[model samples]
Target: MINVRSREFAVPFLQRLIQVDTCNPPGNEHKLSVLLQDVLRETGIASSIKSVEQGRSNLEAVITGPGSRKLMFCGHLDTVSPWTTAAGRYPPHGAVIEGNRMYGRGTSDMKSGLAAMLLAAASLHQDGIRLAGDLIFLATAGEEVDSCGARLYADQSSLAVLDGIVIGEPTGSRVAVGHKGALWLRISLFGRSAHGSMPQLGLNAVEGMMEVISLLHRHALEWQEHDPVLGSSSLSVNKITGGVQTNVVPDHCTIDVDIRTVPPLQHGPLRREIEARLQEIQQLHPDYRYQVEQLLDRGVVYTDPAQRLITTALEIAARQGGAGDAILQVQGVPYYTDGSVLHDNGRLPVLIYGPGDHRLAHQPDEWVDIDDYLASIDFYRELAIRFLGTAEE
Candidate 1:
């Protein structure tokens, strides 16, 4: 394995990673996975790549020692398309560094985190550092969309023995302990199509959707489940499609609703209530009918703030990120992460920490500050020494 002892490797590693277009619509993460496998091999870190689909792949490399519990470092490889951005319009894959920032799609949304994790593993091995437990490095595909890559790796029995998981998602390099879950639903409302010129001959599907949209708001208030860390649970109409032509009253309308949920809000009950509300709306409008379908439903997930892993990360980041004696604070984000899948399904304590700004995740000019990325390496190195160090027992 090629040992990556310095932070300088992060810039080049991330640049190469960004240059690979693993855009989610056609998620060709297998190419990036193959490339990382080759790069990690220089450090003698052998990896196994598993295909989630023909084109999607997840990779894992294990640095082992004495303990039974494992510490897993995970990052997803897929990213949203940035082809429309001005820079991306010319070359979406070029990793351009100007001053302190490196601009490219997925630079912040997590190629930087993946590079950090890979380098941390390689550096630890090169330093002859051995923990009592195993240090598992994972880079998964399809995180920007379906999260299929995470779910695929989480299914392995090898992961079930994990002590904790570190997801190097962009969090401004601060530690984030928890995040809200998401529920996506689609409602199809049916109406009679008639001539647009006809005054009362047709039921407008778009008009029906206005009622459906209104009812969704009222229904959301019924649950009223709120989480202190993640704040209030809320739902919104994200996508609406109705009407075919200007001269015709559309016969059908569809609305996609996105719900950000906190704890104590059961997906089953929330879904049931939504269907019941749609039924109520249908009954109210005898001329129209509707069907509600679940597009995606995942409940909330949170790692305890007091977990040893959490404390260790905070301490390492504080000292290495120049906080000195000050304690680094942890906050919750409103977005979901691969950590949620690892925590919820694999039953592991997971921490969301890494370089770059979360606000820049999918933006056109997304980039990670070189200085921030460098500081993050020191933090990750320390975190490994402390958390993985316990394996010496």
Candidate 2:
């Protein structure tokens, strides 16, 4: 049996995981999934890997208990592409250790959290602890670009038995009760092409898109609703492109909009509102033809602070000692996780807690503190044992 709690076992495991390059444009997560499966097999745990795409996959390993209740520990296996310029000091997959931090592409953004959860489950099995409920470890793919693996699993799997979910996202070892939703949209406007000099001959799509942009800016500002934990909703037009060249009057214009939503804001209604705005534009300019495509939609995920899952986690953290009183408080992250999909429309109580600084996610030289990484394994292990309870209890 491996001493999963020891730094020798935990740190090297994370380093090996980070060494697997699962960057999201290609998102070759199958490699990491295979590695995890081998580790689980060595630990005497059975695991299965499912392919989400040609190169991406998800891994699942469960430790069966005596009862029907189930708890899941979920984390993503993909990371954003590393900086290609000289700005990056460490090799993205080197998993280099300096002092107390492990530097790599996915180290802080989450390979550490995934490693901690896997090791925690291994530790429980090694110690011969039997709980009243099942413990599940899930590693997903494509969270950085789109939650393809999570969405696939949520759509195909039966979530009826799950009592709670813990998302191992980078939360600096603090407990996060929820996170904002993401609504990504691609709006394209089409018009007739004409010579640049004779602009009057063509219906200018770029000019029409400018009007749409103004409307979106005003519409975003009109939202006043706010949640105490999640704060206010936000909208940003992150990317826009139009025209083939300076000489041609381009017939097409496209803009990508990212909207982060909190509670009391349903994505369906928001999408309808935008469509209505487009209709109003069409009413004014009959030639203003446009199409709106939903690129991605992830619902807001919030579990009540009073939920047993959360309270128990807080109690365990308080006992473990680290962030002090602040760790006990309920908080929310701006970024969405697999929980957004796995929450089953808020049916499952989800807890977002993990090692490393979220601020470092996606940044160059991303690293996770070694101490926090090890402590997270302890936290997850203890939380599982306490929340699931022993068969005797």
Candidate 3:
């Protein structure tokens, strides 16, 4: 088995993972999957890779212990678009150790999280030491896109028996309890088209679109009620496209809106309210016609801090010098992840914690701190021991 005790094994493992260009858009993660499989095999852990699409894969390695409770540790293998400049997103190619930091793309975002977990599984030194529970290490794909790989895993009947899930997202060493839900809406405005010369003879589709947009702007302002932790629900028009030519009155215009919802902000009601507002605007402009289509809908994820997993995390954090207090509070994030799908469908206790600065995510100079990555490893390892205990296995 790969030794987790020394920094030697982890350094090389992480460096190799970074070297593999698994940047998404075509996210070919099979290369990394194969490497992980090889590591698991050497460590005497049986593993497998599952995928919805070829090359776009998820890796799962199970450490069977002597307990009934099963816990899963998940991390994503894909990175965002590479840096525009030749400098590289993950930085100086493989792992570059300078002082206290190991610079790289997926370091903070998650490759480091995955590496640490892998090392933990490979390095547990107790010869007869068995865990109080089963540990499942899963490196899922498409977390940066549609969460397709996570959905696939959640749907597996085997996952139903698990006690809970711990998602290794970059939370700067804090235990993130919850995140907001998301919905993508596309609104199309329809109107009559005629020659620009005879402006009075044609209904202006652009005007209809402008009115709808204005109404939404006002409506969004009305939703500014903030939650102490989740902050506030938000709506923004991200895309708008319409007219064909300057001379012709456009027949159609379409605008895409992104909405983030928190608890107390139900999706169905939110949608109904939006439609009502659109109808009100249409009433003032008789010639305007519009339709709203939902491109994607994901429910919000909320868990009780009293759950065993959350409690264990808090206790462990405390033992690690008050690092656990962050686990007690819920926070809102602008983006969505597989956590949403898993929490909603699995009905299992879920928490997000990891290393890396979120500001660097998907950016050109994206990189994670070396210290944060190592800290997350220790945090999760302690969290596991607290819950499973040393005696059971």
Candidate 4:
């Protein structure tokens, strides 16, 4: 059993993490990674910091054991931007505690989970517990935006050694077996600009883009494939911009599309379909010109419900009087996680289990129950022990 002081260590640690703002647009996650590294060092654990970019990095600490099997505890350091409004009502990085919940921007979406995993690893080291396999703690940058840290780590590290992974994404303490894939695209239309009065002289890019939007809307409605566990594959045009002035015929227009997909709907094929449609439009209108930029491409994550990692977690949850049957009922989240990039194409069994309600993620007044946060520490520690087993075993 982990020491009772583990709870005491986790709350303040989480509070400090929330206090440090690592918002995504300018994800200064290296700041939080340094803090985490120092905390691990104090517990006599050696960790390495890998730079992702200027002021962005990923942190990895490993507890080496005799066996080759490995288990990784992963969480992202970056969070969504805090609410622009309601700053006075709920300070973004305040880490304010009201009764059982700790209110902050990253508290639920999930700095608390990151803190819990870190402390859990530290507690194992502090208690001098040696496992039969390596236990890894990975804190990544840019999960809320690009997943650059995870991609860098995946490209550089030897992932074949890992047998399983636990992603501390807020699941409200329930275990999630998978999540939807993401395919974000930015489509830009270009044409000749001219005065609005002589619209015939210029090819209107905004008008062309409107046609593209209509095509996309029709496709979204027509293509309806559903995954029983992950729900439906869907598309939405989240953002669009064009035109300098109302009087001028716009020369450029761009639309950002957010596409969430499930099984059987691969990103490559879907992307090519959009490109093929653009070609058709060009064929119809000789002057039509466009460019499609893939902003992000993350594969879907799906692990078998029968995987040892998940079964063991469910067993532990039941034994600990956790979510019980709710935790046992396997499901997948709609939002993508670092697991999407790190899962090695569903080869690795990644269990998404952590404190905080999934609904609270990215919402204003985000919070994680203090009790849930503390409980997750024990859950992580116990799962590591049971899955890896002690050296004596």
- Highest-TM-score candidate: 2
lDDT of 3 by residue, 1-393 (tens): 434535666677787888887888778888888899998787767899987698888899877767688888888888776665465544634556666666666766678777877766665532445677788888888777777788888787465687878877776666566777888899999999999999788888887798888888898888745666555788889999999899999889999998888777878888899999888877888688989999778877666778888877766666665554554454545556677776646388887767676666666545566656665667777767666676543
lDDT of 4 by residue, 280-385 (tens): 9889987878899999998989989898999998898887665546766778888899998888877899999889988988888899999989989999999999
Model 2 lDDT, residue 287, Cα: 82
RMSD (Cα, Å) of model 4: 2.0
Task: Evaluate model 1: give its TM-score.
Answer: 0.94
Query: What tens-digit string does per-residue lDDT give for candidate 2 at 1-393?
Result: 559789988999999999999998899999999999999999899999999999899999999999988999999999999866597889999999999999999998899999999999998888888888999999999988888999898988988779999999999898899998899999999988889999899878898899999999899888746899988899999999998877678899999999999978889999999999999999999887889999999999999999999999999888876556787788899898989888887899999999999999989999999999999999999989988987878
Worst 10 residues of 2 by lDDT: 320-329
Give the lowest summed-lDDT range of ten residues in model 3: 120-129
Error of 2 at 286 (Å): 2.5
Name model 4 segments beyond 4 Å from true: 1-5, 321-324
Could you say which candidate leads in lDDT? 2
Each prediction's whole-model lDDT (CA):
0.82, 0.91, 0.75, 0.89
Candidate 3 lDDT score relative to the true structure: 0.75
Backbone clash pairs for candidate 2 read none
| lDDT, residue 255, candidate 1 | 93
For candidate 1, the 10 contiguous residues with the lowest summed lDDT are 1-10
Lowest summed-lDDT stretch of 10 residues in model 4?
1-10
TM-score of 3: 0.87
Candidate ranking under TM-score, highest first, comes to 2, 4, 1, 3
